[model samples]
Target: MKKLIAIIPLLALCACWYSFTLKPYPDIDTVFVDSFANETDRFELPSAITEGLIGELHSGSILKLATRERAHSVLSGTVTHFGSEAYTYTAGEEPLDFRVTVRARVRFERAGADSPFWDYTVEGFATYPMDESTKSESQAIDEAVSMLISRIMDRLRTG
Candidate 1:
């Protein structure tokens, strides 16, 4: 009889905690990053951003999903817009370089969560000289976008 009373209070406490505070999230494995949508004509990037996204997700024990239904989280986003502006870059000694400013909105969410959602914009600028090699330019842009996704993951994991 005494055990029943004790168990009742224990269950009540568990229920209260569940109702009041968010549970700790385990690291999610699979994520789907869909292709860029709503892309514009000028300064357009390839549909290959999806592949870049998946490669980034490969770090830290995460897996990329081929289908949305199989993933633990679905990261679907519209490009909304990818805008760029030219700026003077004065990096090296001889000649001043050029710079491009890039901006995009990335929306993220867990598949089953009802209360919380992630929606934000990440902006960054990269500078390259007029005579910069093609490989260098590609690598620079890849780093910027990868950094943006890392920040998004950190927010989702902690928030």
Candidate 2:
């Protein structure tokens, strides 16, 4: 009977953890994110990458921090790989058609005694007609990143 009583406490302690709890997209107190580390030998990556992500997080209203050190979560990432083939004509071809792919990833770290650590990754891509202008291509990348972050937040809400 004493052993059974002791085991009861153990079982309760084990149950305290939640592997699949629908944690409300953690109300991030603050988040610090790392910029994309260039890994491609091709074009130079944009500098606004970090700023854009910061803007996304701000828009999402997930977390706010006066400084990176004060953030409860830290976000960082490396430009794993990026490349794209001409979906249609390469360039200077009549009725030019092409697709530019921007692949980037970000991860988040949260510190909490009662909350489980969480990591989120997001990627996005956009395609437009040729002659859409470089700005458009750039916009596509930002949009993709934005979409990815949104999805991550959505996942947090559900899981």
lDDT for 36 in candidate 1 is 59
Q: Model 2, 1-159: lDDT tens per residue? A: 999999998887777755543354456667676666766663444344566666766775545643666777766666555555456664566555445555555555674334445544455555655677654666655565556556655553454
lDDT of candidates 1 onward, in order: 0.58, 0.58
Q: What is the C-alpha RMSD of each candidate to the true structure, in Å?
A: 6.8, 7.0
lDDT of 1 by residue, 1-159 (tens): 999998999999999987775323455666777675646553444353555566666755335564678777766555444443344545654544554444557666677766435777765446665567653556556555555556655654554
Where is model 2 poorest over a 10-residue stretch in terms of lDDT? 111-120
Q: Distance (Å) between predicted and true CA of 47, model 1?
A: 2.4
TM-score of each model, paired residue for residue: 0.58, 0.58
